[model samples]
Target: MGFLLLAGAITAEVAATTAMKYSDGFSKIGPSLLTLLGYVLSFALLAQTLKTVSIGTAYAIWAGVGTAAVATIGVTFLGEGLTVTKAAGIALIIVGVVVLNLGGAH
Candidate 1:
């Protein structure tokens, strides 16, 4: 559940950041509203995860995974080009997150 909440938080935060790009200096209503809602939900989910997860581990994984996820989201849904280097970078991030979690358990 803690990991689930963390994933949700990361997803929401990515959505919020993407929406912010479309908000056009806050001139667009739909994107602006989405940005606000996404951020609010992201923080709420993150806070909930803190109830069970260690703060340092949670924060590190959250940041690492969230960054990769957001980059994927941008490339896939936002029509941003995906370069080979970027793909490798995302893979590395996933590996790092796994290693971090594994080390934390010991």
Candidate 2:
């Protein structure tokens, strides 16, 4: 259940970030509104997950996963460069998140 909420939060954040790329600095109406709505829902769902999940754990997963997903989208669909540095950075973020979760288990 908590994982479900966290997943929703991740999805909403990813959607919001993707829409932001098309928002033209918030000058575009549709994408701008979608961005606003997506963030609202993301935070709301994240807050719900915090009821059962520790803030450090939840936030680590949320931010880490969101960053990775956005970077992947940028490379795959947004014509952004996928250099070795970018790949290494994403890998580090995933490793850090996993370490945080593992540490929290104790």
Candidate 3:
């Protein structure tokens, strides 16, 4: 359940970040409201996960996964260019998160 909540938090954060691009600096009412709502829900869900999960582990996974997902979304759907360097950076983020979790376990 904790992991599930963490996943929800990551998802909400990614949604919020993606919607922010469409918010037009908060000048657009609809997407702006969506961005705000998504962030609120994301933090709320993350708080729930903290009840059972270690903050270090939960946050590493949340930020890392959210970042990777958002980067992918940007490249795939937002016409952002995907370069070899960007791919390597994403891979490094994933590996770093895994290493953090493994280190935290001991």
Candidate 4:
């Protein structure tokens, strides 16, 4: 249940970030609203997730996965460059998240 909420938060955050990219500095009403809504939903879900998950573990996973997913989306869909350094950073984030989960967030 907690993991499900965290996943929802991650998905909402990623969607919000993507919408932000298209928001044109918040001048575009549609994407701007979407960005706001997505973030609101994401945070709400994250807050619910914290009820069962440890803050350290939940936050690490949320931030790490959200960042990696956003970066991948940027590279794949937004024509952003995927340099070796960027790839390495994403991998490291993933590893860190895995370590945190395995280490036990008690």
* Most accurate candidate by TM-score: 4
Pairs in steric clash, model 4: none
Q: Which portions of model 1 miss their true places by more than 4 Å?
A: none
lDDT of candidate 1 over 42-90, digit per residue (tens): 9999999999998887887878887898898889888989999999999
Residue lDDT tens for model 2, 1-106? 8878998999999999999989999999999999999999999999999998888788889999999999999999999998999999999999998888778641
**TM-scores for all predictions:** 0.85, 0.94, 0.93, 0.97
Q: What is the Cα-based lDDT of residue 1 in candidate 3?
A: 95
Question: Model 4, 81: alpha-carbon shift in Å?
Answer: 0.6
Counted clashes in each candidate structure: 0, 0, 0, 0
Would you give me the overall lDDT of model 3?
0.93
**Clash number for model 2?**
0
Cα lDDT of model 3 by residue, 4-97, tens digit: 9999999999999999999999999999999999999999999999999988788889999999999999999999999999999999999998
Off by over 4 Å in 4: none
Quantify all predictions' global Cα lDDT against the true fold: 0.89, 0.93, 0.93, 0.95
Q: Estimate candidate 4's RMSD in Å.
A: 0.8
Candidate 4 on 16-97: residue-level lDDT in tens?
9999999999999999999999999999999999999999889999999999999999999999999999999999999999
Off by over 4 Å in 3: 103-106
